[model samples]
Target: MGSAWTQSFREELSVGKVKFSLSQPELLLQPQWSISPLAWLLYRLFMLLYTFIWCLYSALLFSSPKWLLFLSHIVYCSMAMYYLLALCNLVWAAIQVRNFYRNAAANQNEGSRVRGGSVGPFPLPPLLSAALRLQWCLHNLVSSFSVTVTLLYWMLVYPIEKHPLSTFNINMHVGNSVQALLDLVLSSTPIHLAHYVHLFLAACLYILFLLLYWLSGGTSLSRKPYIYKVLDFGRWPLVAAFSVIGFICIGLPLGHFLLLVPLKV
Candidate 1:
């Protein structure tokens, strides 16, 4: 069984005959379970509202001095953007549905047969297509980033911290993961095993940010030279490098695999 499962996972990672599509807008709009699209839309809207409001609260809490240092804030911002894109995808879908029905009605009035399985003149509009692509990319990004941020924070940063965590900190770390998991379970969004590349790329980008910050003499809110103690490149360069490499190579793929299990259900 282990061998077979490993083989199956390997097949997913195969680059041969790989294909991706954004032509089916329904797959983007509809839920995996038998639920109304409106329900999904409403859920997305609520998430957007929550994340947006909390982002504002976090801004106030940090008060701009330390806002840019934390990875939590960056991931939270990405989550907000993901939810916003999701909401826009739904609204665009609704518009297409309405137009489709209106066109059908007009055709019926003219005594012409309406074509079935057509939504707003077939091939989706260019703008909607672009939006769906962006939404898909962000979905993959947030899934990995949220889980990584939560695990890293709780395991590495929280344990050695001298101060107790605030509600905002807890929400940013724990709640973000919950939101991402709920999105995975509740929606029809597809997760491709090979898409772990997105996570790896994001990890690399963050490492670059750390290097730049170090070079620029940026500090944490506590006025420490590094953002997080574990990631303090200047103080413990080897350890920090290994931590990033491990996350990019192991942590990201593991998180993506966990997400895939839910989708397979």
Candidate 2:
């Protein structure tokens, strides 16, 4: 045991001790949102509405057996899948927003209110939240690809092709491009070139699907065994060359531009 020695001190003395604690600001760790809550909510509603309208239009066209024949085209197939993805993303975003609002309300004990400018609540574990954000990024990237493909087809392919205009008219070509562009603009994810890999993969899968469909004896309305005359497998060399050029030059660049344009704002 040590002896307690009394010493004379001139400094201020207090009966109780003072404690100091340090805390990290939540903003430092929270994910940065690219858009406001109100904007995102309105965009979600618009996507849901646009998806419903497209589905109804497709259903009406499918009612006719003649119109059903046009479904073999890659344009219709890709646009259909794009809208479906948009609907899915919309649902996920809605759920996230709801949870954000609820959490903000419950956490009001800390004097933080759920407002349009807030970071919004994210209750998901770190890994799960990251995965969700990645999915959202890929989803928007695909939306950009859909728009690029649709416009390229319309301006370049459809104009030169001799396919029946009646069949094409029933497929809602303009609407598909417009809705996809809207989705791309309304997306809150920051655009990154690395995400372009998802677009490439999607294109590759679509090309494979077209090849399989052709192998199964699918024929377009023009009586051509190929959906796009340029993609006719009979000329494998031309098809390969065009695919390479399209992916590298047209598809990648177009998608990159489409995604970056809105971000420039």
Candidate 3:
């Protein structure tokens, strides 16, 4: 039993293997079940627009001077980028479809001249292929990271920070997770077990940024040494370290697993 379970775990990780792909762009752009691709496209467009408007509003509300300090803003930007890339992928898919039909018609004409000759479907352009892979990675990263940020914000940051519940606050914290959950459920994007590494790396990068910011005596807009009191590594290194570990090691994987449940169902 132990050996069998170990093998199953190994297969789940698919270690040393390239788990991502640029082929079958439909898998990234289309819906999972019978929902129309047009519907999915429109939904993605709506999300893109919604996130953009709020992001612009946020920029104006907070102003440009303090935009870089907050992790919430970073995650919001990531969310916006994810949707934007998704829209681009949909456009690419549409172009690929049109090209496929055009190629087929041309091949049919050529086949009459040279009987039994045919051509395969159109291949993705090199640039679009790379963009699809980026979209896939962002899909995994944003899905897990948005949920983690939401959980940490409401559970940890809200109480002590004592920030009043406002529209922007709710939108950034709660609405981001809602969007992620909807995307996970509605989209056909596949999530791999090892993809959680993206979230882990992002967490590590933020931790490094925190250390550097502290070392350089950087401060939040409020002029606090740390970005968030929970992540105040300078004052409470152990707490911050454990928080990062818990989110990256525990929260992120669990969130990814939960997101997988919808796909599996």
TM-score of each model, in listed order? 0.89, 0.58, 0.89
lDDT of 2 by residue, 9-89 (tens): 111122211111012112212224576655655655565565556555665755643344332233444445544554454
Residue 231 accuracy (lDDT) in model 3: 80
TM-score of 2: 0.58
Instruction: Give the TM-score (vs. native) of candidate 1.
Output: 0.89
Model 3 RMSD vs true structure: 2.7
Note each model's CA RMSD in angstroms.
Answer: 2.6, 16.9, 2.7
Q: Residue 202 CA error for candidate 2 (Å)? A: 1.1
Per-residue accuracy of model 3 over 1-265 as CA lDDT, tens digit each? 7787677557667864236765566688778778876787788999999999998898898776567667778888888999999998788778887987686778688664424554555677788878888999888888887887787787888988988889988998999889999888788787867776777788789878878988999888788888888788878988888887887788777777777655534
Clashes of 2: 0
| True lDDT of residue 3, candidate 2 | 25
* Model 1 lDDT on a 0 to 1 scale: 0.80
lDDT tens digits, residue span 1-265, model 1 = 7887788778778774133466466777778888876677788899999999999898887787578567778888888999999898889878886887787778877767555634344557888888887888888889878888887778777886744677887798899889999888887777788887667778788889888988899888878898878788888999888888877887777777778876644
lDDT of 1 at 106: 84
